[model samples]
Target: MSCSDPRGISLGPRQIADGVYWVGVNDCLKDLFESLWPIPDGVSYNAYAVVGSEGAAIIDGVDEHLTYEYVEKIREVVGDLGRVKYIVINHLEPDHHASTPRLLELAENAVVLVSTVGARILESLYRVPRERIVEVKDGERVSLGDKTLRFVYTPWLHWPETMMTYLEEGGVLFSCDAFGSYGALVRGIFDDEVDLDYYLEEAKRYFSNIVFKYSKNVLEAVDKIEKLGLEIRILAPSHGPVYRKRISEIISLYRDLSLPKPCARATVVYGSMYGRTEEVVQTIERVLERSGVSVDLVDAARTHPSYTLSLVAESAAVVFVFPTYDASVFPPVREVINYLHVKQAGRGRLAAVVNTFSWGPSAKEAVDALSRAGFQILEPVVSTKSLPSPEDRRKIEELAERLSSELRKFGSCA
Candidate 1:
C-alpha cells in the first residue's frame, strides 16, 4: 500500500498478510546520544496494526511526538479511532510508551494491554488509570476480532516489565527490544530489504550497549521463544529495522552473543603518563600479532567506558598498562577497571598488568586492584622506572610472551 508523505508523519506500510500491516515510523529520536554519536540519523519506532473483520489492535506506538500522526494513520486504515479495540504495550520504555497517554485518551474505550509489571510501571510513571489496563501473563491470549494476540512475559531481556506479543494468526512476533538496533530505518525496514552488514553491526552495538550485562536473562528469553514453535514469518522490533525473511538468523545471532564463550581476540587497554606506558602497550600488541592473535589497542583515556566494557566482555583476554602517580593508578584506567570489577566481566578472562613509574613505587596498587577484581593474572606484574633498561625490556618481552601463550590456550579451549 502507498502512503502520502505528510508534514509530521513518515509512514511506510507493508502488508504482512490479508489484514495485518507492518508500519514504519521514521527516526523517533533526533539526537540519540548526547556524548556519543551526537548526530541525527533519524531512528525508526515501529508499531504494527492487526486489522480483522470486526476490530483492530495496535501493537505499539511511536514516541510522544508522533502519537497524533500514528492515530491519524490508524484512522485511515480502521476508518475510526474507536475501532482500535486494544493497544498492546510490548515495552514500557519511553520511546515506545511516550505516546501511550495520548493514545489512551483517543482510544477511550480500548483496553490497554500489558504485563502485570508493565501495568504497574505505567500507573506509577504516567498515572494511567487502572480500569483501562488489562494485565496479562505468559501464554495468555487476547482476541481482537479474528487475530489473537498472545502475550509472552520475558523479564530482564532489558527491563523487568519487558514482554513480547505474538500475532498467532499472522505468524508475526512483536518482539520489542530483544533483537533491535540503533540508527534509523533509512530505506527498508526488514533485514532482507537492506544491507545485512550495516544492520548487524548496528544491532551488535545496540546489544552491547544496552543488553550485554543481561546476558543470562537474554538467554532465558530466547529459550522461552524457542518453545513457542510458531511459524515466525516476521520479527517486529521497536527500534531500527525488522526481521522479515531471516528471522532465525537474527535469533541465532542473539543466542551466540548470549553464550559464555569468549571472543578469540584480546584487547590491550592502557593509560600513559608521557609515552612510556603507550610504548609497552604497542610492544605487547606487536608480540600478540606475531603469535597470530588478534588484538585491539584502546587508550582508556580516549575510549568511552561503554565501548571499552563491550570489548573487554568479548575478548578472550585483557591487558592493562598504566603509569603510577602518587602511588595510585591513572584515574581513567582505574575507573574502567573498577567498572569491569563491578560488572564481573573479566572473571575467567586472562589478564596481564603492566605499569610505569618515574620515581615513586610501581603500579602495585593497580595490580592489587585488578587481582581484587577477580582477573586471573597470567603473569607477574611488569613495572619500570624511568625508561626500560635492557633487563627491564627483557621482562616486558617475557610478559608479552606469557600473555600470548595464555591467549593461545584460551583460544584452543574455545
Candidate 2:
C-alpha cells in the first residue's frame, strides 16, 4: 500500500507468508526502466524479509535510488540489520541488486547467497568479497532454523545468474524477475488487492519486452518447478504485485506467453513518413478485420516497441508496412524490427512486408531482417512506387488472403 512514504515508515512490510514480509520499494521517479522501456505506472523492486526463529533472510534488493526506503523496510521487519544472516540475490541485475552494497554494509554478518554464476558476477558486478558470498548450487538448501530456503537454478530467464529462492516451510517462491511485472505496487501488494486485469497486461508487456527472447528457457524453468512438486503457495517476484490468490493465473499466463502457441490474431506494425505507407497499411488492416481475423494495428511512430513486441509475441502473424527512407528501412520501423529480433518475438510467426518509395524501395533488407529473426516471410510482398494503384491494391488483397489463410490454419479466433 502506497510505497511513496517520504519517511519510508507508512507503507507495509506486508506479511506474504507466516514470516516472509514484502519489503519491496516502489519507484515513481524513474521515467524509464533500465533506461529503455517507459514506466508510466512506475515499477516496484520487490524484496522480501523471511524471518525465522534463529535468523532472518532478505530475498533480493531494490534499485540504488530506493536503498534508503528499502533498508528502512528491513529495519522495520528485523529491528537490526545484523539479524539478516542471508541476503539472497535471486538475480544480480541492477534493478534487483543495486542496493546490495549498502545492504551488505548494514548487514555486516550476512552472507550473500547466490548461484555459481552469481558468485562470479557478485565480484565482477558488485565487487562483493568471495568470503562474504556463499555460492549455492541448484537444489541446495539453506536453513534459517524453522525456515528452509531452496535454490532453483533458472538460467537465461533474462540473465545467466537468475535463480528462484523458495521458502520451503512457507511455500513461497522468491522469483526475482521470472514471474515479475512492470507496475508499481502503490495500492496493494497482492494480486487479490489490486486490479488484476491491468497488472496482468503490464506483466505481459514486461515479459514480451524483457523475457520473450528466452521463452524456451522460461518453459524449461516452469518444467523444472513442476517436476520439483514444490507447492508454491505464494509467488513473490522482484517487481509488480505478489501472487497468492491468483498464483495459477500468473503461472498460466507465463506458460501460455512463453510457449510457442499461436493465437488467431495478427499484429500490423507500420511506420509511415508520408501518407503512402499508411494508406496501404489501413487497407491491409481492413482486409484482415473483414476476414474474421482479430488485428492489432500499431503505428510504430506512435506506439512504443514494448507494446508492439507484446502484440507480435501473441499473434499468429505480423505485417510490416513502411516507406523506405534513403534506400533503407524506416528508422522507427527498423527499431521495432531490431527489438523483435532481440526478443525473438518473430519465432514461429508469419510476417509480410509492404514497402513504398518515391525512387528506390528496399524490401530485401527488411525481408532479410525478419527472415533471420525467425519469421516465415509470406510471398507476394507488396511494394509500391508511390501510392497503391489498381495492381498494387490487387497485390495487397492477395497478401491479405495469404495472411487470412495462414491465420485460419492456426485455429478459430476464440
Q: Pick the candidate with the highest TM-score.
A: 2
For each candidate, what TM-score against the reference? 0.87, 0.96
Per-residue lDDT of candidate 1, residues 9-50 (tens digit)? 334576666687765476534654323432245556778888
Deviating ranges (above 4 Å) for candidate 2: 1-10
lDDT of 1 at 400: 86
The models' CA-based lDDT, in order, is 0.76, 0.87
Residues 1-414 of candidate 2 have per-residue lDDT tens digits of 233534333356888889889998888899888898988878999999999988999999988999999999899999988999999999999998999989999999998999999888777778777689999999999989999999999998898989999999989998889888887776688898787788899999999889988988899999999999999999988889899999999999999988847756999989887687888888898888887889999999999888888888888889999899988999899988898888874475789999988888789999999998888999897788876689988998899988998897777656
Q: Cα lDDT for residue 382, model 1?
A: 80
Kindly give the stretch of ten consecutive residues in candidate 2 with the minimal lDDT sum: 1-10
What are the RMSD figures for all models against the true structure? Answer: 4.0, 2.2
Please report how far candidate 1 places residue 120 from its true position, in Å. Answer: 2.9
Ten-residue region with minimum lDDT total, candidate 1: 1-10
